[model samples]
Target chain A: MSSTRKSQVQSSKVASEQIKTQKDIDMESDEDRNDENRNDNQQQSRPKLSIQRQDGDNTNATYSFLNEDHTLGNLLRNVIIKNNQVEFCAYSVPHPSEPIMNVRLQVAPSCGDTKKVLKHGLKRIAKMSDVLTEKFQNALDKYENRMSD
Target chain B: MYGMEQINTATGFANAKFGSSKGQGAKGFDEPEIRILELSKYVIKFELLNTDLSVANSLRRIIIAEVPTMAIDLVEVKENTSALHDEFIAHRLGLIPLQSFNVDQFNLSDQCACSSMCAQCSVQFKLHAVCSDRDQMEVNTRHIQPLSDAPIIPVQYVNDKGIEEDPILIMKLSKNQQLDMNLVARKGNGKIHAKWSPVATCQMRKEPIVEIDQDKINRDLDIEKRKEFVALCPREVFAFNDYRNAVEIENSDKCIQCIECLRFAQANNLERAVKIAEREDKFVFTVESTGVLTPEDIVSRALQILMRKLYELGTQMKKYGVNAD
Candidate 1:
């Protein structure tokens, strides 16, 4: 009974045709379901990083980092801008609600690759974090010792 | 920032780096240092010197968002005849902070191999409360008991005199009202939910640089003007010096950059007499923990988490074939 009702609904939708082919209707519904599934997948799984390079320029590029905010964006841009090879570096979150950080980098031709610059900046930031951790630990220890005394 | 070259050339691609000698570089670019100003069990105050604002902000953000702790995430209600709804009780249970020093022993529920929850991934707690004879009864976290013998427990606050304070109240039960439930505590970070955040308040502020020209104030302004200028600062940053008959900075750190004194100085046509600026390289940080972890532990863990994130990004970039030539 439900199938007959569905068919009746389908037929009324396609009333312009005298007799709409059942196979065509089934194929159209299947395609719509597949499109919905594809959209669901896209919404569920966003890639970690997406890179877009200028048409003829390897030195200028924009990188979009998924699940990132000002924490990574500001640090990476600061480190990248400090590098002599970098001509310009800036980052923006694009939208506060979305967890997307876009960083634009333009480097000197001598540097040659923007990805390498980004990787180098990451290493530097990591090293800086290492230093911060060590210093903080030392300070904590000193404070504890003083309190104990 | 100007001494960036010194650090860049320190371990040279080509040898002979700049600022190889000690004590002769830009303020922040020379070295980063930390000084613990105050430390308690739950609160810590520190100064991060010679660091960029971006670096300080990154630390602040990581401490707030990435530090992991154990919190009750899922609750199963067996019988709840209380006036409150099940979801309201479940949400209150989730917000309670558990002692998570041993959080490293458990895996995140999603990362664990368990079908739903297991001993290695989650801690089970049972709460049973009933008001039989009393007109009113209070239900608190103390009534919630752990199913197994794990170190994880609800935070127990202590007063300065080392006395255990009253437990956190969850609800009040009327006559014959009973509540029975099972709670599952899992390891997570603030990014997932604020209940898992280890810190109550993690904040950083720029070091205020307040300058008052005593000589100019003494020469140009009279006692009335000096009193008015001192009263202009809402934070009491300026005090009138009766001896020198000048307006002087009493407590510069109290200045919140209100610019009241600066406006008054400008109105008096005293150029550069009162200046207020912030040290770009210095930041004062205060961290208050939610009893799941100590403030010091939170700071160290945040730095470690940040390092891990950077390392993961680098590896991920390499996996995508972004390696150097």
Candidate 2:
């Protein structure tokens, strides 16, 4: 995804596309599970935005992001780690030549749900990235305007 | 803070308090809220709150001395007719910061499972520079090329036309001088050598503060004298507010604490006119990278390295009945 984006210099399109792909991937992961068990888990709890992990248990979750990651994985790990519920979070590309990156998250049982917290943290990071993109554009515009003036 | 005097009253020496009523580093131990004041590909300025002195110092040290990076470690000089000695050229090669994303595949030479030095432990680069022309020519990093199949090594600077330009001049070659060398690069941390240090500059300074006593200024001296007192600072830390007709500290951080601003006040016998000091707890950190890695990446890797070391220390001390968390 990073190669396709080719955003050595960041752009708004690349930023939004990353978030869009992440959301899409999350939804697809959600679809992989049987609907009946998801219904059971939903009926058991009425909490807001309950994100049940399909391929993971309560302890750990691992997801593969193809090309959508490069340095962003390291950043996302740091972001998710801010939460007290997180026991550990790390992302690593298996090899430099490979486009795949794996983000692994571990949550403490004493805290909240792992999947919800991780998803929420990703959302917050996406929003923060968008805000940073805006700030960068504004600063560049201001510098250009000053130069022109 | 509870000094020696406050220690006698409560439940013996074990219960003596220094922090807030909560406990020793308990309340503020939560994840610090990081605020990015400035950022770019090469340099970044950021602030974080709720950090004690040691934690903040560790971060500064990590950025300065812990981030693992790729640097030329061993150089095999096959032939050298240049004025520079072989050892000097090898040392120079060891200091060049190579641009590449360091992968986990390469290990610190000593820690690698391979018995002999191999590709898993090092990357070989060859430099052959000779002035084929009659005039004098300079040798640069562009002359160095990775002889290994792995293409992890890159020049620090690339022009808009995609041509690579060596950021540093390796040496200058005359008509007859020829410098040829084969160098090996390995992944290592700055803790082992300064050449592996990622960030160009990682420094932290206590946040500066300024205190102004308007009543003292107005009562002791006339408006003209007060303006003179403010302008006495060599750093121009003070600027006159035209609307308020008062001399105020416009840029307090510029204060060098030279006590130059105190001259007029002391001359007039009013010593309380102004004060400048640095906050002991609050620190301003600036990190600049060598373009090998982004400044943000440098900071993140610093934090991760520090945390990993602390974790390792905790785990290793478990035999002595110590817990990490």
Q: Judged by lDDT, which candidate is best?
A: 1
Each model's iRMS: 13.3, 17.7
The lDDT, on a scale of 0 to 1, for candidate 1 is 0.81
lDDT of 2 at B55: 47
Candidate 2 per-residue lDDT over residues A1-149, each given as its tens digit: 11221111111222244456556666775565456457647644532222225553666767555442334465556556655556667777888654466778777777545556555555544344333334434544564466579
Docking tier of model 2: it is incorrect
Model 2 residue A21 lDDT score? 55
Which residue pairs show collisions in model 1?
Answer: none
> TM-scores, in order shown?
0.83, 0.62
TM-scores of chain A, one for each prediction: 0.72, 0.55
In angstroms, how far off is A67's CA in candidate 2? 38
TM-score of 1: 0.83
Model 2, B143-230: lDDT tens digits are 8888877756654765557776655898888887676667778787665667778888888777777888987786777888878876
Worst 10 residues of 1 chain A by lDDT: A4-13
- Evaluate every candidate with DockQ and list the scores: 0.20, 0.02
